[model samples]
Target chain A: MTVLVTGVGVVLPGGGRLADLGRTEAGSLEPVDPRSRINRRGLRYKDRATQLAFCAAEEALNDAGLYAPAAEAPVRAEIGIVVSSNFGNLDTVCRVTGTIGAEGTLAASPMDLPNASSNVIASSLAIRFGLAGANLMLCSGATSGLDALSWGRRLITAGRCRQVLVLGTEPDNETVREFTDTPRMLDGAVGVVLEDAGTAAARGAVPRLTLGTACRGGTLADCVAVLAAHGAPARWYPPEAVTADVLDGLFPGATRVDLAQVWGASSGALGVLQCAAAIGWFDGGGAGPVYAVTGGGRDSAAGHVFTAPPGVAR
Target chain B: MSAVIAGAGAVSSVGRSVDDIFTSLCGGRSGVGDLRVFDRTRYRAEHAYEMDDRPPGGPDVPLRTTRWLLAAIEQAARSGGLGDDLEGVPVLVGTGLRELRSVELRHRGAADIGPADLHFGPAVRERFGATEIHTLANACAASLSALALGADLLDAGEADAVVVAGTDMITESMFGLVERVSAVPPDRVRPFDRDRLGAVMGEGACAVVLRRSADARPALGVLRGVGINCDAYHVTAPSPAGMAAAMRQAYQRADRSPTETDLVMLHGTGTMLNDEAEATALTEVFGDRAGRPLMTAIKSMTGHTSGASGLLGLIVALRSLHTGAVPPTLGLENPVPEAAPLRIVTELVEGPSLSTAQINAFGFGGINAVAIVERAR
Candidate 1:
């Protein structure tokens, strides 16, 4: 029941290429105006995180050949979605709550209230894409991104959907910065389309990478151990919170790629961004069996093992 | 491999424990009352199912969803005869609004709610000593989804025992949104009622300890199967087709027919669209057997507990199986015409031998989750 990662899309700062994930810093990049990239018809009421997600999802869906812009694509009930974000709609929620606190409860607009829902970002993607499958929004602390991936995998493995869209988005704004303790937060979204092997093969979609073994627990060490049971990783993308010395003790001799140094604080988007980085590394002719682990703070961590598929340019 | 409910705990407006809530429901006691949690003078609707008593928690746990969650989990563990230390047990928390009330309090300088508190994983680990934690924000269907995931984890041998919980508190933000949306707020929640105005919000927390049926522990009930789906239709609207699809999926997974279900706990938000959609979905799924299952809507008594409502409904369903009586759906003076094909339990119906029950939880964003549970043989 192996799931294939057929598409990778990112709305990172500075228009960074996915191939240059760990090789370069994201720089002092600003958020991209999603208005230029996506349709503006339904963008007015969408929160920033959701807008970024739409941008990433469009690219990922197109890359997977499942969707095309203005192509009158048939609605797919077999495509599900899983979203991971801790502060996706913080600004919208704060605005609504602030309005109620300052002016009366009646002051908050009903139109903007839907955006205040924690699952708004995930739901918005489902609505725009006509994906009627299982939709879940995970805010499971530091490992949320990986948690989302796990759910996506489950959906496919359980035969609930043939392909699942997994997005990890965290919006950077004044409200999020004020409420969030994580420094250098990622300002955009990262999306990866996970398809069942049979479906991908039938559609002739080339896999960017194949998911190996993935596990999560209260700490990074626990997840690493679970994945390590399969095989030791050649390269490891450790969370920014984890220092090289600690990772050296955990996975000795493995090349450590600190993603936070490249793309700010990943927060909830850590796991998907890590997988995207792994795809980039593999595309760069890196070796197989890479481990990407997110979470080192007080919350739980998730480690996923991925390998370049056969004939993936070696 | 089957997953059984080892223990259950709850804190609703009518009662604190599962038994108390069941008794209150059987007696048709409504938890709806004055909305004193916030100033109600400014809003058209002034009543909600607000909790009168606060549960104690560790200093690290804030006093909103986290505190209630911890209390519910602790009660669940104790009732299941577990020791003080949960050790390696994994904890899953589901919520529509995860600690937004605490965030609002922090905004008003009333409390110091940190970013970590927003996600219940760290707090769950700290208080329960559980190494693995997952927080799901699937809106109203969250808790049932958690239950489904928990069962999956057990079936996958990920954990020997898992605790799944859901909690939400009435926030001024949500109240404001409901107020603005409702044309006229109903004095009380009246699910399936023809004259039902709209739903009133409630605050509560509920938890269930789940273990493999092979554990040989005394169980409250068995989770037969769960089906989840997203309508993708509208943000605020429910789809009858989507809801029926979920029920069919659940029945398929359970390997049980719709006719086997003896009771059904309706999502029944009392909204015009929600009630109509649910009734239509039930009719579509059950067909001529629509009137066979004894249907009850607990929201009429518990008000809409939001994320916690699903687990709360589940607890009531399990209690009904044990007590051989279905709780009444209060305020159902006139059944909606759409629900005529379906049998609505308006009064406490006793002396019915029940074995299987279905619980429906539909949330904003068109998220629908249906779980089927059967009595432990």
Candidate 2:
């Protein structure tokens, strides 16, 4: 069973859609207030990271034509969600932690306690969207976003769910900045709607691209070796740590595109953002077999191969 | 093919080794005591289940969660006979707070926090030489989710052996949060008791080395399947329907009927709503057979270990399957009305010849995960 990326949504700096992913450089892009993009009813108590997730999720659902009126929402339990974020809700967690440290633990509001949990963003998204499928939250360093996609694919192929919303988001806040040291900070969310190809066809939804071989390993060489099993990639989206000389040695003929340089440090959003960029490349008449690899400056890395779907003009 | 538990390790407040913990549980000993991890005078309740074997430097140490995790992993590897080197094998960690306690300790002028300590990936890499790592924070159901992912990796031929583990340290913030939220100050965790107040916080780490059944190694038990789902209901509150659905899903994936289940490890948190809801879920899933499955809530003695609770309960259930001696749910003098439809183990049962067991783990955000395990034939 093949998995298809049917929808793409991102809350990047400036104003760039799925088509302008690689071309437009997000230069010190300021975060946008999610209240303007999403419903304001449930926006009061949610943290900024969750609110950003909501914005990106709304756009992705709308793009997939899966967004329905509240009263018209069909059985939502058939859909699942996988979220990847390392520092998305650290601001809230730190604030609550600090409040309990300064004042008594009773000082922290009951409303804010839920946000202290690492799974808050994923759970909040599920509650807001009424998705009851196998929900998961991944925070496995830089390759987290790719791990989320991998899990989403497993959930679909395992028949746990027909469609899974995979989200990768990060927020650059005071607390996150204190804990993290990155070349560039990102404050945005990227979402993709992954559906079983058969389910997509039955729903009359056009797929952006077909997911291909995916691999994760302890080192860049391991991932590269496994991802190269099918054939040499036409284009390679390399991690920030991989230089042109290394890429040349590895892929040789393939073009190297670094999205981290295009848009600041992606953190957990690296892999999903890379997939969104691949979707844009395919839409712009790019060729097939593009591999996006990310190693969050750690010993581990995750990579996925994206191929243009059959019948798509290359 | 089912994934076999090749080796297991655990370090909870009750005991350090799995055998010791099982013995403590069977002896009906309660680990709950005065909260010493933090200043307890500020809270209404001074009692908690704190680990006696804390690493050197007391409670204000950095990498507290990492230390516990590495200890458990070491024990798991040693017992599973996997040796010290785990070079190519993948390690999946399920943690609710991860190193939040460490981060909190850093605030009070503790050792400088390393970036690698924030997630278990770097530490696992450094210690075990594991290249591929996944850390999941699926609330309290985190470990079961990791176990499920491990099973999936085995099923897909991704790894011949995978280490699935969960660890969490009770932070002052979390301890205080529980204290402030409970309807009444919880003096003890009385799961399914009519007068149950709320859950007390506990800290520990547990790990299991999973290998394919075809490995021809000694097996603790066979992990049949794990079912995970979100209630999407409420953040702090659980949904009985969602809980039942997760259990039913596990049974279905395990290809076993509820009638075949001889033991059930309940996710009874001793909270007013959680216990009642769990009882309701049991009734819904088992129907008339709910009373047939012998059930026990280990939280009554271990307290709530957060993410580590799932694996801790699983270790108990596996031991039960092995020895036919089930642990008691201490302090269950009077059963709640909702529990009337089920068989609650008030004292240890030494004989049942248990073959199959189901472990339920429900977390905040309505994340529910249930794992099915069977004795090795």
Candidate 3:
């Protein structure tokens, strides 16, 4: 019943396309419309969150080589979609609520109501790709991204879907501003394609790692400790572990990467950034096990332990 | 995969607990009363089933809605005989108003609010000690969506048990929205009646403890499947032809035909457009067999509970399956002339063992959700 991750794609504050995100960028991370570059029209109406999801989904499908033709092939109808966000469509919500509050009730615009929905991203993707399987949106604050990942793994392990597109997305808005005074509300998306070991091997897909047991703890400290016991590097810490003293306690030898410098201090998008960091470290031919901790003040934490591939130095 | 309703609870104008509400319902009592939830002197709708009994505190309950939500969850846990603390249990709450009161207070300049003041997710977490909590704001369909997602979590093995709650209280802001939509009536809600004008507003909260069938107690019914569909046609009005796709999807997922259903718990908001569309959808889907499934509209008695309507209907369906009798549809003296020839239940009648029931909840944003529940032998 174990699920394996075959591919990972990300659109984050670190800039670059999904393929280039993991590698060193020549310049700073900048926001670019991947859809526009790809000549996809009518994408202007989509918010940054939806755009991020499209970019990541496109990249993941490309990496897995699951094109429209392949998706429409005579395979089982078993592709589930699980998308999660903390402040889902916060930008849209703020706009709608502000409009309703400022203007008279009768004057409230209807254009923004659809965008305020938490499931808009997933629903849009499903309609675009004709994915008629299970679709769910999880909004559990900081842990939402991991929750989606867990559900995707479960779908594969339970034989409900041959593969699942687990997306983690967040768009910057006033809600993010209220959470952190700093501009941490970065916009990004990451999608991981999960499949069972049998299906993966049948398709000649080499899994990067076996998705392991995910447990929720009462607090971030407890979560970190549990992950550490399961082989997570002790140097990793929660997002709040940014204080100098806490950083000293966690990462002793590693030089800190100022994530805020590239992507703001947003909570939900941190998971995508962390996933990007893990992929970056792996692509750089790093050795041993690298731990990625993503969570915030909501007491939500997801620890991912990445072990180097064989022949990679420890 | 089967999902069992391990525990259920409700806090409405009908009653605060399941047993209390069931007794009142069986006795054919109505919960409709004066509209005290807001200043109704200026409004046309002056009657509703407003929950006036506060739980040991005033309006300052962190998130005002969370107080009622906690009570319902606690009742569900108690009824299910679960002793485990909800330390790590995922919480999914369906609410049309995520602290609507708080927003009103801020708008009136009665209180200064922060980001946390905008919603109920954090308040529920603090009250129930959930490991993770999610809030769904799909209007009337919110609770059904929460239940559907919770069932998915169990089916996917995400959690051993989940607490899914739906809560909303009457708010002036929401009333304004209702007034604008022309869905609010001047007095009591009368569903499926020829003289029905519109729906009266009400407020309530309901929760269900969902678990895998293997882990649940033997007495509860089984949640067979749930189907959800959204019509991108309009934000306020339903799809012109009705949610035919959603109905088909529900039956398809349940592995049953419209003829196999024993009862249909209609949304029956008493709104002219809503009732007509529902009747058309039913006739189109079921045809001659539409009358075979005994139909009842509970909103006539309880008023429109908004987000809690889905769970309220779920509770009533469970009761019907247990008692082998369907509750009467109140306030339907004369059926609409154009309505389908369905067997509208006007008086409670003992019938054959009801095997399956379908509950539908349509929201403001064209969100349609239907859940099929089966009697667990």
Candidate 4:
């Protein structure tokens, strides 16, 4: 029941073109037309969030090497899609509700109603890929994306699904304009494929070289203590903990990679960016356990322990 | 420890309590009527199922939806026979079409939208004194998904008890969307009926408490199994294949055949497409046994509560088990040919004490979820 991360896909700020996460400059999300990247027709109805998730899902599935139909004619593995977002479908909400509030309900666009759902982005991906398993969306806050990844692992380990496409999506919107105007918001989508260890090996896909840890119902200090027990994490990717400088005092020498430095401290897609960057660095031969922690409005923190597993060629 | 339903509560267009909704539904009462919450003269479909009792939020308080949610959650927690102090427990809330009323009020210069009231998680955290909260917005099936996730957490020994809730409010956008798509009934919602035109828009909130079976005292119903999947067929249309797969998955997870189940609570949105597709899915899953298990639809009276719809149906199932009689599916005078053979409970059907019942919740974006509840052993 060991759940392993096999592949990942990321769509970050600066228009989905990533020369490198570490070196990339932080800025608001640049325009990336999903129509050009999606290669599908009839996408005009879909919102930008859905399109971004679709684009990222495609890349992650391709990286996983298990996108082929599993014996069935067209049905894929009962792979579920779990998406996390703080401001999902806000643009659609603002536009639709605004129109209705102004000119009455008759003025609202019917097409916009469905797009204002937090889960539509996930369902959009499922419809395209034929993934007819459990579809869930977590809409807590910043750490929800990390919660989604941990929950994806649990879903696979519990035998609910053989595979799961875990995504964290946030599109540019006016709802959090002031926050983004400052330095705590970014928009885009990031995805990862979680699969069984045996399945990943059989598919000849190099697993996301690593180990990971998940714990719920703990304070910030407790979270760091739990991570401390696992042996001081080599590199840090802490989002909520950044408000407090205790991490530096605890593990001063560990190279702390500030995601805000790369993603403008935006809570929306920052954690996912941190995750993608950590995995990218791991895949690129960065050594030791890559620390990733996120805790937002909720009391508990979600932590991940990543290291290249022994004898696995990635 | 197994996840079990210890208590339940709901506030639909029909009634404010689980007993009120289920009893009214059992007695054949229709809640659909003219919309009084707002002006409906501009819309084609003027009638709707609106909440009679308004939550307390005038020019002073912001986020009317949060008030409704808190009321329903408090009611559910109390009715679950548990004490009021639910501090530090994990909370997962499924919400639909949020912030419309607040935004409208702000637009009208009536009240300023407070920061604490904007996010559902923080609102619930502050109101209930909860440390952890998660909001799920997956359309009508959100509550069922949240319940499924809570069950998973309980099964994994993550929490001793969890509160899963769903809430939605009747907004201009919701009603307008149905009218725009021509998915609104002219007068009343006739679920699975021959003359059923479309679904009627309605809104409400529902909450349920689940605790580890080993820990829950005097549990009412046990969470037997759950199966959730995306139709992947279309966003708004139902997929027979996906629906059948989900039903099959649920029964398999329960380690029992469909025949073993006693009753079914249907999504039955009253739309022609939804009813026919649901009938087709039942036939595909049950085969010759399609007509065996007695099924009932509550949406005829409850209307479609969007994200909160499934939990209202869950409450109905619990009441059926408790009363030992199935609630009647009002407005179902003539059954569709696709569902003729199946026992669509249009009348108050008396049977053996309900042992198990399955609830189906489907929504836009092809989101499908099934949850099985069984009488505690």
Candidate 5:
């Protein structure tokens, strides 16, 4: 049985709230409003990566309508949490290391230590939702996002979990500055609610895309070529290209508003843009086939392809 | 879905490969020696099984430990008679120190440790042209977690095969950290021994190629199941009850009863708390039947290889299954009084055709992993 993505969500460079970002169309980046939906207390406390994840997860759960009593039954003990990050709290690690090096171990704050762990995000999510099933935090540089999705699909297919929350979030780090000597780091998060297609359909859950095989490569060219050979229009987007490349790749000359100009570089946020793009096109009464590409260094890349629902484009 | 161990490799202080380590273990040799990799003159424990010579694969590549791991993988693949194109095969590498060399350089005020140190995954990816790479850093359980992830991936059909590798070498930064934790003994590792003080640090690398049973050669032992859990009890100290939950989960996944377990490759670090916890956990899971299972600790001879310990245990279990002789638990002259009345192998003991072996690894941050191996027909 193939695992399908029933719902998707994102929080990225453009906006804070799911609704605010949900209206985004693929064209150019847009400036985010400070008072947007993501300005909540708990959301504000989170680092950029955590913030993105929270937004994406919230949207996913909302779309699945899984926040009600039925989905929250006590006997539903098969919900698993799996998240992947390229750097895994690199920002917090840098802070703790600097503090320890300068002020000695005794002066280190207790709060900083827990936050520095790679599993902090997964642990926090587990605590939040009372998910006690298998939890894993995978770190494999850039490919971590796709790997997490692949693993989540496996868990669902293997009947280990009835529903799996798979999230991939990466925030800009000081390491980006230190190594690239450039300040162009993108911060965002993406999540997909994966469930067995038969089970999901029975539960009245609508799937946005039927996920296929996820593959990775050692080099960017190889990644693009392999994906393209698999019927995906894999194209490389330079840093300056922004969402223009994405919109062009997906719709060619289709009329759409470019939000990248206002949002800036989304980086890991491409997944978010794709979700928003799908929704925007659907809402705007214009669509056929839509494709999205998200890539990052550390060899991270995720691509999603889907077709519009019938009668929407007609 | 079962995954078979198609290939295995190692490079430790005992020897450069599995053959060398096994030969030395059969001869009852010890690899613990004075620490030479780093100047530990100021530290409390000055002994370690440091990898003295350049790893069997030519010159060191600055900060990347993946180079050594790749070498071991190459050896394992050659032994397993596998192909060079690891495309579409998942690569999971485990390590206690992701970039220890980078840490050392930063401590010494080096401006940059180069791209090699900054990006460790790409180094391995470039070498073998892997389709995917997953790096895990869970202290001691890193490699075991990698094995578990491999099993999960295979069961998920993410790949036809997976390469799980664990590697850790003694570094100045790691030496300092161990000294601070005070887990290192002044002498050698004496696991489960009454007078055991602490663990002896060591350096090594081990890799195993795993494939679905259908794709695996009939000769290789099958990786039956893998169980992993977080204790969430303590950071450094294990649950006094040991990893009962984790072990139960493992046995349940393996579909085996406690009495069916033929042997146990313990994660005996020789520390007082570690020994006590392991014994307690074993007793709880097996009850009176626990004492019937043949138990041994290999760290007394190989020293504690941190992330690589669990993989070494797997290698030892495979060798034991092959030879039908369980290796003795060296440095365990006087067993702890509180330990279970299990038949501890104090000397190399010839045994019946062993069908099942469990390898256990508990890491810092309360990470615990158990891997079950079944002898192939």
Candidate 6:
């Protein structure tokens, strides 16, 4: 089955559209007050992670022109929701626990419990959009984004759903001070509309990119070998361009793209930014097939092969 | 392309071994007890099913849940005839929402993700050298979601063998959330009982090893089919349509009718809305053929283990298939009449052989999951 990336929504520390986000000199996108981008009414109870994800979902749905299922025929069953985040709302958990511990259980805000889990973003999106499809919350730490997308693709191929909105939502909380302080950890939310090629073309939506096979649980060597086995291209597109002396041998003379330079280190959302970068490369007059490896400096490794959409003008 | 559950293990308040847990269930056991770790004098719903014994494993095993996981995996490997060497098997684990106790401190320091997420799946990957690891945090129904994914991976030939595990520990935050939500019952867990107040929050871990039927030998049960859906109606409330649709999809995938199912291991959280919605879903799926499959609520005894609740339910179902006895839904003497045409097994029944069973797991985020289990042919 041919799965096409129909639309994308990205919010990084760097300010730019998905296509223009790659400029090295571009600073990270600044945080907009959650109230500024979205309505505050139902937004008061939600955490920043949930708020960011909602913004991205709305943007992607609008981009895909599939924001409203009730408006169209062939009734859109709830869209499958898959989100990847590692401790998306650690602060909420802490505050809820601390508040209850200090005060009484009744004193704690009831709203915190619902948004405390990582899946809160996805579920909130579901309720916001009235999506009733299969929902999943993947927390593979750094590799969460790719794993999330992988699961979304699995849902579509397994005939479980026709389209899935795969998303990565991470917030910069004081609880994650260490990760944020780290050299490459940029915090943000990114989303994409993954639909069947037939579905996209039916709506006259042009495909932005095509996600290929994704594999996990492998070492770097193991990841490289598996990608090689899958006939993945020797060319590489990493979050950072400069390669270490050792990893250079994995993909000889591979042209590298530095996505983190502009977007910063977004953790699991890095995979989303990488996908956007790949789409940008092709959409900006580059060729097909970009191999990006996530979780290089973290736990586990996943290799995703994405190709430019067919027949898109250079 | 079928997925066979080769081996399974669990660590609960009753026991660590799956066989022992099954035995205890058959003998009419209640794992619910007092919460020991924290001072619960000020809190409501002080009782819960908790593991008092320390996690049994090497001192090197890092966290509380990680130790339980390693022990369960070892047992699963041994029972499944897969041996200790799991060279290429993929591991997927489902844990609770996040760390409940140390969420504040763990974050104030280095950007360490919470201890729960870090210590579980990553530990499995590092200790066992697992190439692939997936950590699902879909709240209570997460384990079932992982099981569904593992089955799909096995069927797609993407994995030769897959291990699916779910673990959660009782935490003050979780307890607070349970209390705040008014989900904890006044006294004991009494599923399908008219006098039932709410559910008792429980804690534990369960693991199951799965392989393609062609490759697996001496399998415990075949995971015939799995269906999952979200209510999208509310984050905390169950949607009857979503629940029924998921069960219907499971039966459709397995090409079997729900009426023919021998037994059903319900999520039966013992909460008001969950039980009511579940009963409605049951009626929607098995309309005229009601009062057929015996309904058993294991949470009435085990308490709700959150994410691991589904796997725990599956454990009970497998035991029922093995022994000719079905465990009674403890604490359910006065059954609710509204869920009529559905027979609640309030008493232990033996010799009523069952070859097929179903497990229903509904999470807080309106996630509904159902898995069909069948006796290996």
Per-model DockQ against the true two-chain complex: 0.69, 0.65, 0.17, 0.51, 0.20, 0.57
Which is better, 1 or 4, measured by lDDT? 1
Instruction: Please report the TM-score between candidate 1 and the true structure.
Output: 0.95
Candidate scoring better on TM-score of 1 and 5? 1
TM-score of 2: 0.96
Please rank every candidate by DockQ, starting with the best. Answer: 1, 2, 6, 4, 5, 3
TM-score of chain A of 2: 0.94
lDDT of 6 at B9: 85
Instruction: Check candidate 4 and list the clashing pairs.
Output: A184-A266, A185-A266, A211-A305, B7-B80
| Model 1 stretches astray by more than 4 angstroms | A68-74, A225-232, A243-250, B54-62
lDDT of 3 by residue, A213-276 (tens): 5656656666667666765352332463356565456544544444434455545555545545
lDDT of 5 at B182: 56
**Candidate 2, residue B363: CA error in Å?**
0.8
Clashing residue pairs for model 3: A184-A264, A184-A265, A184-A266
TM of each candidate vs. truth: 0.95, 0.96, 0.79, 0.92, 0.78, 0.93
Candidate 4 per-residue C-alpha lDDT over A1-314 given as tens digits, one digit per residue, 9 for 90 to 100: 56677878877666653336655465555656777676766577888778888878877887886564322447664788888776666656656656765676667777786776657787777877878778877766656777787778778876788889988777665555542344435566788888778877776777774447765444566566777788876787876435555556755567877766566544545556666777777766777677777764353455666666546443
- Evaluate candidate 1 and give its CAPRI docking class based on DockQ: medium
Which of the CAPRI classes, incorrect, acceptable, medium or high, describes model 3? Answer: incorrect
Question: C-alpha displacement of B52 in model 3, angstroms?
Answer: 5.7
Query: Can you tell me the DockQ of model 3?
Result: 0.17
Sort the candidates on TM-score, descending order.
2, 1, 6, 4, 3, 5
Candidate 5: deviation at residue A255, Å? 9.1
Taking the tens digit of each residue's C-alpha lDDT, what string does model 1 give over B171-263? 667778888788887788999888999889888899998887535567899888888888877888889988998899789878889999999
Model 5 chain A is weakest, by summed lDDT over 10 consecutive residues, at A232-241
Residue A310, model 4, lDDT: 45
Return the lDDT, model 3, position B178: 57
How well is each residue in A1-314 modelled by candidate 1, as lDDT tens digits? 87989988988877765865867556758768898887787788788889899998998898888775422554567889999999887776778777876676668788876776788888888878888888889998778887788889988887778899999998888877788765567888989999878889888998888988877666777887887787778888887667767777877778888777777777889899888888888888888789888886788677888899756655
Q: CAPRI verdict on model 5?
A: incorrect
For the candidates in turn, chain A alone yields TM-scores of 0.94, 0.94, 0.82, 0.89, 0.71, 0.87
Quality class of the docking in candidate 6, CAPRI style: medium
Per-residue lDDT of model 5, residues B202-294, tens digit only = 878888888776453555587878776655444456774437767887787778777888889999999878888888888888887878878
**In model 4, which runs have C-alpha deviations exceeding 4 angstroms?**
A15-19, A27-29, A68-73, A175-185, A217-219, A240-250, A265-268, A298-301, A309-314, B55-62, B79-82, B98-111, B114-119, B183-185, B214-216
